[model samples]
Target: MTETAEQAVQFVAMARKSFPALSSMRGSGGPAAAAVRSAAPMASHFLRRRGEDLLMKAVQVETEAGLANVREIAKVEGLDMVFFAPVELAASAPRGQEAGLLLALETAEAEVKRAKKLLGGMLVPGRSAEMMFAAGYDLVCTTSDVILVRAAAENIVREAKPPATGPKGGLVRFVTSGREAKFARNDETLVTRLKKSRQARALGALVRLGSAAAAELVAASGFEVVVLDHSRGAEDLLGAVALVHAASRAGAHSLMRVPALSQAHLRRALQVGVEGIILPGVESAEEAHALVELCLYPSRNLRDDSHAAEARLKNQPFRRMDFSFAPPLVEFYGQRVAEFSRRQGEALLIAAQVDSPEGAAHIREIVKVEGIDMIFVDAMRLSGADVERIETAAKKHHRLLGGLLVPGCHVEDMYRAGYKLVCAASDHGLLAEGAKACLKAERPVE
Candidate 1:
């Protein structure tokens, strides 16, 4: 044989040796081709699972018998994702909970053949079906088993007694801070899916973005909340307005962590549609009080414009609108027109971060301040003693206590430490980790 032919033969041998599974999957034609075509939408569904978006609604099936229940569950509108649970456990669920357990295997749009196409295989143990479901929501949000058990737990909770704190809806929220990206771009396919996921995960994570185009993808990829961090020098506060719009489109609970405690910054953030503010370096009750008042729409302003037209603050001189006259407000106005104080009107949330020793000393006083919903201790900055101090104050005041997700620490540990809300590492960190993981994956034999 010629040298080139010998090299080609070696390459073919290596390719066959590397892709043993591909040989089994070689005949993915006819029915499989049709399955791939039909499952394209399912592929998009997995990618679109955004942080602020709704958890893609799913129902469970355990056995062939469960297929009979599938059509019944599909009746629930907007129900898309489907997972399979262990029959022994799922059989115990009561009727009300059953609505959430059953999923459609065949429907007006889907036949059993089409449903099989989406999953590609039955979700038995060690099957890829389970993995497909895990990727249904945020990879960090949960695993496939958690979804199955949560449903069963909810059923048990409902049967035994009423929930201790209602249905923990929107309780397990994640907040991710944005890092300055020198070159931040995501896959065009992923960007498209992120847009799709926004509509569903609209209520997920709070995030900060560095720029608009690429950073907007950060907002889209399930971390819908825009965290306008101090370090992200995006021209001015005005630039953050577009970030807020992107977050809004994603249906995120937008929360900004400002550079400094400026009334102008607070006003601009709120006007653009920030649902919450994370006040950093909070020290005293006086600071907490100022943060609350400025965070609120002026009660007096509603009575009449008078001096309200001038949106000027003590040192800040720019005159701009204070309240959010954006689409959310516009929708509210369309429903009913009324002038009322924000004390009774607005649903905005205010969070104070205790990062300094002075803040620790005044934690009790700060918690006493009304209008605030959470007390965040900067666990990354403070000592263990400081976190306990802030946590005690938070529990005493019935306010949610939050902190950063410490490296190498389990989220369960943070919860046990009495931290209800935990901010994850920066987006850049996650991206770096992902890149490292991708590089670490073994390639096919050469």
Candidate 2:
């Protein structure tokens, strides 16, 4: 067996001792486990059987107290990453607080960068590709809000700009009332104007291009590690893949966000070569532990030749070898899931969504799980103060904490509090534009 695989087995064995509950879940007589053993080779089966060993603890924090608490946990228990919630721009620039907001964001970025430099490793919120580029965040998470905002921003810009000028002797010059924008020689203002008039119909096309641009920005920024927010549906997966492909082409790493910790989504994401899986709504350590198992090992319990063939057919050259499997769907599923849990040992990062006080309470136990790597508090559902309280409590329990930012959340406050990785929903295009803007601002003027 490979050293990594062997190491995985050892970790699983150790984990079994610490997390007996996981063993119970994989009941001794469970047909799924037995089926994997009977079908796959003994070595593969052993690796698969040792799935639970690779779990790690992670959490989400959204307040200064929470940040301090997370720092305390990191010092004591080796916390993984601190994801700040809602790393986004304020709607309308926060009415007279734009400077303050910008300063806060800059400060947060500086703090996160400092932590990474000093602490060896750190995760930060990258709602847009520009944010990721500007901050050099380790993890970039795209959100729907950012996407929509970017699209709107792009449309406004496109509409605001006058159209291209056609050939001198060709189409008539069409100009919008706003300052007769001058174009360079050979520019096609007429064509540009026509394109702008048809903007409504071309919104889809623009968004797609924008999405690709965002992914490209993330890729070019040298922050290749990105986690796409895919909690919405399977359709979002395609967009995430597109972004990954674009990012990869530009020299970045990409991970897909799964709807939840289900085998189906995990299987699909893996098939596409997503570097990691972002699981939502994970309420317990058992669930987190199970997710880690699924990510590392192949699922030996499921089988389907058609699926294997399909994966092979759509293969990309940039795909990772970790996902290069051809076993029957059932067997592959069991093997991957089991192997992932056993060998990787908590390396499988999870962004559990906590929307309620009850869920917040459950986070403590979830962090205690041997394999859970991160916890992402959902700001859309939890108040900032409540999230802070949870982080404080979690710190007392020696758990790492993170926070999530949605449409109307106070992300800056979360950053100040010490939450590291903030996410917007899934809007790849917006992320690209934002990244581009950030890049432009940082570049030296000619």
Candidate 3:
């Protein structure tokens, strides 16, 4: 049988085993539950290899000791691992602006290079475009908090110029500054001063541009996966789509975040052909089932048949729908949901948006959902006290917890807290800004 057909058959079998009770839960819940049970096995079968081959086996390393800990985890996790190295080690400087920051950037870049050479590929959080592009890391995660910084860096780079020429056309002077520095002849005081000032204002712009450029470069260099950190709105969808298209063109994999899993947003994202969906705020099995149902071809809700036909004609997969649910409730309903998703042959992801004091308890319950393939933690909702609790719970359960944040949050902070995936809000400028941010976030840092 063809791979797709074989997958469908496997899904049916797994559904039967996972949700025997699905037959009894008649009504809206019944079908959804059955679908998930059915789909889980098939989804698992397809995803297992991909997860093993492409998913970054991220490790949180704060120091050399932490690196050692990560190495141990890699061994236990099997082969082809990627570590999310600490941002402080990779981005922060020990002292002033003179050499410390530069040293830090270089160190971070070297560390990533070393890891990629040793581990085959790894994920890393980066501050500068140079570090991110130079390191050759597999994936790079960005936080909403740093958008301004990114924009600044891009602007600086854009304004930079080659060394100026003297009256006789000899080289005049070279300005060595951040990534934005420009070169000009000593005689061209007026132009250099204006350029320097302009560069200062464009610092944030420069960073943003650099981030995007870095993503393009990474894809061109032949990375396997690119994930974007988008937490707020749908603005990042286009950027995500662009990255996906670019990566696909480059023969790489691309993934992005849909701030939430609404039907409209999910459809739009799927239309763009994103390989994965990072749904935030999922808390229950029923919700998980609902998401799976949405991912299926016939979808729980009716869709325009014409659109499906068109997608097929264009060689595009039909868009999958997604559902969101709060916690505690998913625990009781996840199995049914998994069954329904399996029967339908769709992709489903469970997002754990831990915003309340009871989030840890809720996550503990969520981990038990038999067919849940992935888990996302809404860090924006999670308080400082809840970080360790949630991390420990997710780890013990062997569930993947993605980190999410609003604009201005730190990717390193989330990584340090044990979040392998980081999503940031996409709304800042236009809807396209969010879209672009999503794509850039997903691009591997290397």
What is the Cα-based lDDT of residue 191 in candidate 2?
A: 18
Candidate 2 per-residue lDDT, tens place, 1-446, comes to 11122333454355445544322445546877567557754634355345433555233333333333333333322333445432212211222332343344445555545544212112232234665555565554443443465567769966655555523424444555321232231122211222233221100011133266765765565442455556553345455556657765765445555677765557556645444456777766677667765554342211123244234323421122222132212112223323432322222344455667666667667666554444666656776675776677555654334544545556565555554444433345555667999999999998
Candidate 1 lDDT tens digits, 1-446: 11122333344344334333321345545676457648674533343334114443344444344444444443433344434433212222331233332233223114422343222223322224345455332111223443465557668856666445668544554333231120022211111222333222112233444556534666567654455665344435677667666655654445667767775466556555455678888999998877876664333222133234223222121111122122222222212112323222344557898888889989999999876667876766677788788888888887766666666787677766665556654555656777888877855446
Q: Which stretches of candidate 2 lie over 4 Å from their true place?
A: 1-213, 218-225, 233-242, 299-343, 393-400, 406-413, 424-446
Q: Model 3: runs farther than 4 Å from truth? A: 1-215, 218-225, 228-240, 249-252, 283-285, 297-361, 404-419, 422-446
Each model's lDDT: 0.49, 0.45, 0.42
Superior by TM-score: candidate 2 or candidate 3: 2
Listed per model in order, the count of residue pairs whose N, CA or C atoms clash below 3 Å is 19, 85, 75
Misplaced by over 4 Å in model 1 are 1-209, 212-221, 231-235, 300-340, 343-346, 442-446
Ranked by lDDT, the better of candidates 2 and 3 is: 2
- Most lDDT-accurate candidate: 1
Q: Which prediction has the highest TM-score against the true structure?
A: 1
lDDT of 2 at 200: 11
Tell me the deviation in Å of residue 122 in model 2.
43
Instruction: Report per-prediction Cα RMSD to one decimal.
Output: 25.8, 25.8, 25.9
